[model samples]
Target: MTTSASDKQKSTEPVTKTENSETVTKYSRLPETKNSPVRRNNRRPQKSFQGSNVSGPIFQYFMTGDDAQVATTPTKKRPSLGSLSDVGSSFDGELPEQSPRKMTICEAIDEKFSPVNYSACSFTSIGLSPVKHDKDGTVRVPWTLVLEDRNIAFAGDSDTLCKYCGNVRDLDLSHNDLQSWSEIVKILKEMPHLEQLNLGQNKRLSLSYDFSTLVQSQYTNGEQSKAEKPLSNDSPSTESCPGSEVNDPQTEHDVQKKPPVSLPLTLPSAEGLRGHRDDFVHTSLKTLVLINTGAPMDTIAQMLPRLPSLEELHLSLNGYKQIENSVMKIVEPHSRVKTLYFTDNHFSDWRDFAKLGHIFPKTKNLYLACNQLPCIDISFEGVFTSLESLHLGGNKLDSWDCLDRLNELQSLKSLRIHDIPFYANYDPDPTIRRSLCIARLKNVSHLNGSAVSPDNRIDAERFLIRHYLDHHPKPQRYFELVDKYGQLEKLGEVDLSPIEQICLQLHCSEMEICKEIQVKPSITVLQLKTCVSEIIGIGLKDFNLFYKDAMMEEAFGPVGCFSELKLMSIQLSTAGLCDQSELHARTISRHHNAQRQPSR
Candidate 1:
């Protein structure tokens, strides 16, 4: 009872219908590749499931034996289109068929594809089913093959069942075409040992699942529900289907029963991540790498305080315009953080880093490279005591004097001067004079006796000269007075004619003469006259030593008739002038002594 190919074609032919007198209408069978249009139109039946308000479930259905059969209905009209025989002539011959391979999941797992060595396990693809070891006769799942505490799953085409391995500390499901959030949530809820999860580059997944509502509905008691409402009704309510009724409390409770506990983890994606705060549970996150994630700085600031154990954070290449001071203040209390990287963020000011010094005193490595920092005058001594290395390269610095205060950083070992403007301007020639280099070398430890060329010596000398010669006129006047009036003077018993003549010849001002003639003890009348003569360049050799002694007696007798003149003469002579041979030779001649007391 075998049928020919022509007979099978005729059985699937189109039915025809006849209109009033001459017109005919016909319907032809669609090609084998095209789906039946009527079945496609009727496929989408409106059936909602539990938790449909929060998330939609994927639907799959299978038809039974009777429902799979196709039925043909006869019509009264004749077909206007070409017959089946005409379509059959287009093909030259029968096409060859392909034999399907009988590769079961169990058989694929049994064949030893490769030895699962932990050191060599960089598997790009993992198929479903367990790997069977021939030697030990043991079956091991793909997840169990991970030796590291953190497990990353990026199986692109390998839809391996990610279950049963509870030891995985971290999981990365980036770049996989995971279209269902419910499936990912189910896997995450089941993997109890999972800690950190990465779902970056999964453009199809959404992170907007209401985990708070899910938690409250499942875990809260009646008292807890009364104390804290199960969910915030104030949150904007989404519209339900027009005539659909809300689920009863029992049904909602049953549907919200807690699945097996999994690790608190992260699920990130490019799309829908801006508004997806519910995906981040920061309680267990020790470190987070959010490079190129496009998360706003304000959002990051708001979220960072909640992460209790967050110790290291990397926000490189996140296109942040500026890191707010308040953001630093919020993270300042998180004492556990030891490292923070803000490299390539285009920051121009370094005043914000002063707060960082106060916040993370124990921080060892801070990367602030590739920014437009023009001036940095931070005191890195007490703050960076524990700092090992600091990177401030690729900035617009003209001098390294700003780092002079960092001499107290004893723990600082390696300072990278690569690409810094000051280092870039460094010349290897020993003759080049750089004051900043000299100062830095002098202050740094273990660098003594280093010779430095005096670069700023000219400026320093000019400054000193300006300081010393501020006033000059009074000093010059004193010098003139000493030169003119500093000479021996003479006086007589009832006459001071010689003293007056000496004052007139020198043109001495009263103050000048008083200052110069105030340095001698008492003198006799003859000695006073001799002193006055010496001042006028006259005869100082006329009086003998005995004659001078007699004049002193006469001047002091009977209320001292010439006592003032004697005192003035003695003061001028003893002050310095008449006592020295240089002054006497300049004033009076030695030959005058020959006239007074004959030649020896």
Candidate 2:
């Protein structure tokens, strides 16, 4: 195979998911020509197997290269397929001469597939087969391939994708037509060792004239329509809402068969998830993705506690315009969720984040990119304290104050800020923008998609310090930031005032002790008073840097930073009377440790 310069890739762009296919490393366009028989006939996996909970397994993602080349990099190798050689004829490494291909069937998959290489193994259909206890896949393979619209027959709980891949950790059932939540649970009962589940693009429920939905829809739209009042739950049919039963016999029978839901939200409880017949609850599953499923946040929220082992929950592109009451009940300050994603949801307000203080206590990664978020307020910082990697790209965030707020999130180490409105407000200089963002997020290891170099960080911080010092010099944020990150290397060195050593003799009868302390030229009387309080074992309100000299008050008063005239006189006195420079700890003997607010 001849490889061109363009075909030989150089850069190491890590794993990324596009809107369409779920590639392992990054999105690569498949062979677009019609003659490329390897191109997928059906849609690609509807969602990314978002690998936030990275403990159990890494699926050998089979990606298609530009030359109809199937790129398969398997992390783990399963047993060899030598036993079922009699079932199928031995073949050389080449694709079958069929359009959709003849190798896709589940029975045909008995012992042929291996993780090492599957480039020529093109298949069109996967069948429903009961799991076999026979050794080395006599009737069943460990992993099964099933796609939604790929002419695969998935007949309820008996779907072999669940039964065969039961003990395996990660499972992707994206683009499947698993319609009802009940049907999904039936499938879930089989996968005992599933560590991750991706159930995107499922058949959405067609609900209509429902009062709870009407009220919620009205609330989301900022106005109620014809239905202002809620109907009583007691006055109900069996179809999820009152008087909403379908006229068809199958629909009516199905409705009548189901119990009436009294609650306004369509969320299922733990009890509902596992009825009396459930064999086991899957505590091993860690990550759950429900992208584009159209399930309400409340419904998803209700599903949280039931799945106690979940570490990451992704619900992207769901039509949630607002995080409302029912949603807040389960999400805020509650959950074992370590990484949560609400991408493309258009959730804007930051004030509501206050309720999420304890949510995801151990959460390290968070992705909320591509929303209509305007700004991240100061109060919002505490909510994201536990995050390590945060994605806030493509939001409407439009201010520098948000940078200050972001800095307050102590544990944050990675940040993505692409297409933010703040960048739009500034001149289109990417270097300046990148430098400022790096400086603002001092602890960030990675910015956008690249690593933050130490030299780059130093330079960025230097630029940031200069930028701030030139604009707003003496702000407390400056002092605090400088104190933390230090003066930005040699390029931006902070200068300090000249200092002198002062020997002060305490007037205690025990010993003639003199304590040497460093004093700056512009040191304050108030600061001296506080120092005296610490040294003399006197309360702050009682201790005083008292000087009987009448003119000292005028000298130390708030005209400048300190009493300049008194300091000059002290300097002169120090030069002439160089006799160990003993200065007594002056006090009102009648009223020892005499200090006050100086009469305001």
> Against the true structure, whose lDDT is highest?
2
**What's the lDDT for all of these models?**
0.40, 0.52
Candidate 2 local distance difference test against the native:
0.52
User: What TM-score, to 2 decimals, does candidate 2 have?
Assistant: 0.47
Worst 10 residues of 2 by lDDT: 48-57
Clashes of 2: 1
lDDT at 568, model 2: 25
Residue 46 in candidate 2, Cα distance off native in Å: 38
Cα TM-score of candidate 1: 0.36
Over the stretch 1-600, how does candidate 1's per-residue lDDT look in tens digits?
Answer: 997989767755645456676333333443343443332222212121111222211111111222222322221231242433421122237532321121212212222232221122111222322332223222234543322211111121111222223334565544333333333444443344454555444433322232333333333332222212212121111221111233468855765574544443332322323334333333455655554444455445444444546677676666666667656644434456667777777777666666566665676767777777775566555665566666666767666555554455667544444466766566654334233333343233221223323444333223223322443432232233335434223323495433321211121122232112221333444554555455544464432211122344476863332122223334443432332111111233457755777556
Error of 2 at 435 (Å): 2.4
Residue-level lDDT tens digits of model 2 in 3-102: 5655544321224545567344442445444776545433333221221121111222323334333333323343343332322223547644432211
Worst 10 residues of 1 by lDDT: 149-158
Report per-prediction Cα RMSD to one decimal.
Answer: 30.1, 24.8
Q: Give candidate 2's error at residue 297 in angstroms.
A: 1.2
